[model samples]
Target: MELITNLPVLAAILATFLLAGLVKGVIGLGLPTIAMGLLGMVIAPAEAAALLVLPSLVTNIWQLMDGPKLGPLLRRLAPMQVAVAVGTLLGLWAGLLPGKGGATAGLGAALLAYAAFGLLPLRLPQVPPRAEAWAGPLVGLLTGLVTAATGVFVLPAVPYLQALGLERDRLVQALGISFTVSTLGLAAGLASGGGFGGGALGGSVLALLPALAGMALGGRLRGLVSASTFRRCFFLGLLILGAHLLWQGLH
Candidate 1:
């Protein structure tokens, strides 16, 4: 309590998590992306990454278990999952370079890329099954590297999953599988970098409460709210937030 009593930071962290969890509850994605993007405004991307470790892991694990097909999903995604972990370690190596603004700038660039991808609605041509054999691992690698660097893991990964031609429900479950693996990889990356030596654990735990509450609220709203409308609002909001983070990081 004493540590988080500092009003500004605590308020910011809690608000970020609540908002993020609401987005996830409604759209089934964007927890880390929203949390990290918003938190980066008040803290470094690295510290924000550290703070998200626990909540991301917990939420993703819940999602991963919600379906009965976990065994097949795990087996199918094994290559991509392994590549993601490797890429995360590689990105952590780059994140270790001593610099003033590089990590922030990198995070900003990632935000810009993500925002652009979202706003434009660009859909890649679906890859043939043979291609996925290679493309899956490649996309996972890129997603993992980005996750390690900016604490946001959506980039090529989400788009890649979308292109998989799975049914809607299966797609959602696939996201859970990908996110669960990615969260674990992120924890390892941050741990290796000494990002959790201080009060990050307490902060993350405190933030989790609001996140879960917001998810419950958003879950209820899902029946009442138009998802497409909410998604439009969400992405537009992310566009604005991403722009702000980019500006802050560079200037």
Candidate 2:
């Protein structure tokens, strides 16, 4: 891929992934969000998505395995995951995945919404235990559509998960599980669309190195920083990036 061959682009990719991984390490999320928001500026959204697959998949898998409640979580979330896969493939077949021009605007909108959710004092209604049967699938389906369009899947899904009233550790693990599935769904969609060829796959693998390193560093720094303060700054950054992309797309 040109991204790998071009020194400047490669450097940007490495640095972007490193920063993204650091965020994920400290906060337990944001790898795909940060990577997509930054890399989307330098590359096509599809190419950015392709480059994101491996690092996201690997890191999320690590997160998923860290908790002891995997079995229970999977049993609770299985339906949602199935819907995520189905919705992603359906979105691909429907050609909802962004192409050149429209994709930028769509990605920008997704990022803006996600950032706003984080920055706002929004309180979603708690999900009653009985509601999971339907709510889970609905949220998953919407998340898959967003993932297909923007390669970032933290909209209704994140909110929905939060509403489920899981314990802190369980919630984190659930997020990992959901994100892992979303990444796989996205990978399949990209591959079917011919966006995940060997070059893109190779670039993604290469990107993993810096991402992992950044995660290690972020893990070490987590103890020294106030998470709430860092989170505020992170959302603010996303807000600016999202606005820029939105403006660029509109023009």
Candidate 3:
């Protein structure tokens, strides 16, 4: 409540969510990516991540629930999720937000990688069933490390899921499942670090309204636009943002 009364912080929170939700609604991903990348510019990465907890969890749950075959998907993804949870805790213990410079630099490098992948057509080799046990844990560990440091988890997680040879819809649902677990794991990490102060908690809850509203608008917009082209523009913008974060961190 007190923080919301501060116009600048409130405005930043609103804009962050509106844009994040719009991205997710259109592309079915990037909510946390945008929120952390943009919000961390104005606030601490830990606080930015903390503010994402509720909305990210809720929206991803919505995504996870849409597909009917959650049971099989859940079973297949269990090891990955467990590894993510454990790895997130370990990464946090290792210094979740290291320092402003270090965190921003790490995030910048990650965003650069993410943006580059966005431009390329990534064709991952299929993971054989026999390899999933080892492969899944490796990807989960990487995702958790990124989430702990950068507040983004798309790197190995999404690409790994993409390589699993699942159908399109199943891939979407699997991403949702992974994101949901990441959100919860992130929340736990933030709580452990005392990032969930009153203002941060309130900002997270209040940001949900704009997030939902933007999602609704974006959903409507999806029908009227070419999403593939839109995604290209989104990636370009992310590239610029990544460059800025890198500059800020290095300087």
Candidate 4:
């Protein structure tokens, strides 16, 4: 990959992944979101997406296996996972993904929405047990579409997950499960679009080192920092980044 050969870009990639992983380690999420948003400013979103696959997949898998309630979570969330895969593939088929030039705007829109959602004190109604059947698939489908377009998968999915009223540990595990599926779906979509070649895959593998390192560092620092304050700063940064990307795309 030219990105690997280019010293400056390679450095950027390493730094970005390190920071992204740190965020995830501290907050239990935001690796993809932070990585994609930052990298998109420096490269094509498609390339950024390609480089995200391995680190995201590996981390999410680690996260997914950490909790003991996998069986029950899978049973409850299986339909949503399937729908996520289908919707991602369908979005790719419809050419809604990043390489198309319009995707920067799509990504910007997604970031703006996500950051706003995080920053706002919006309370979503709790989803009843009976509503899971219909609600899960619907949210998954929407999340998949956003993922396909932006290479970031935290929108309706996160909001919907929060509304499910799961216990704290179960909620974290559920996020891991959902993100793992989304990452896989995104990988499939990227491969089909010729974006996930050997070079990209290699870069992704290399990127994992920094990501893991950052996660470790962040894990140690988690107790030292206030999560709520850090999260506010994170969302503010995303809001600014989103505005810049939106302007860049429009021009």
Best by lDDT: 4
| Model 3 spans with C-alpha error above 4 angstroms | 1-3, 98-101
Residue 80 displacement in candidate 2 (angstroms) = 1.0
Over 1-251, each residue of candidate 4 has an lDDT whose tens digit, in order, gives 79899999999999999999898888888999889888998888889999999999998887789888699899999998888888888887788777576788877888898899999999799999999999999999998888888888888788899899988778878889999999999999899888899999999999999999988888888899998999999999999988888888888
Q: 1-251, model 3: which lDDT tens digit per residue?
A: 35567789779989989999988887888898899898888777777887888889888898889888699889999999998877777888788653444898888888888888888887879999999999999999889888888888787898889889998778878999999998888888777887777777887888888888877788789878898899899999889989898888888
lDDT at residue 20 of model 1 (Cα atoms): 85
Clashes of each: 0, 0, 0, 0
Per-model TM values vs. the true structure: 0.92, 0.97, 0.94, 0.97
Off by over 4 Å in 4: none
What is candidate 1's CA lDDT for residue 149? 68
Give me the overall lDDT of model 3. Answer: 0.84
Taken over the whole model, the C-alpha lDDT of each candidate is: 0.77, 0.88, 0.84, 0.89
Q: Can you list the residue pairs that collide in candidate 4?
A: none
- Clash count (model 3, backbone only): 0
The local lDDT score (0 to 100) that residue 166 gets in candidate 2 is 91
- Order of the predicted models by TM-score, top scorer first: 4, 2, 3, 1
lDDT by residue for model 2 (1-251), tens: 77788888899999999999999988889999889889988887788899999999999998899899589899999999999888887887788775554777877788788889989998789999899999999988988887887788788788899999998889889999999999999899889888899999999999999899988888898899999999999999998998988888888
Q: Candidate 2 lDDT (Cα, whole model)? A: 0.88
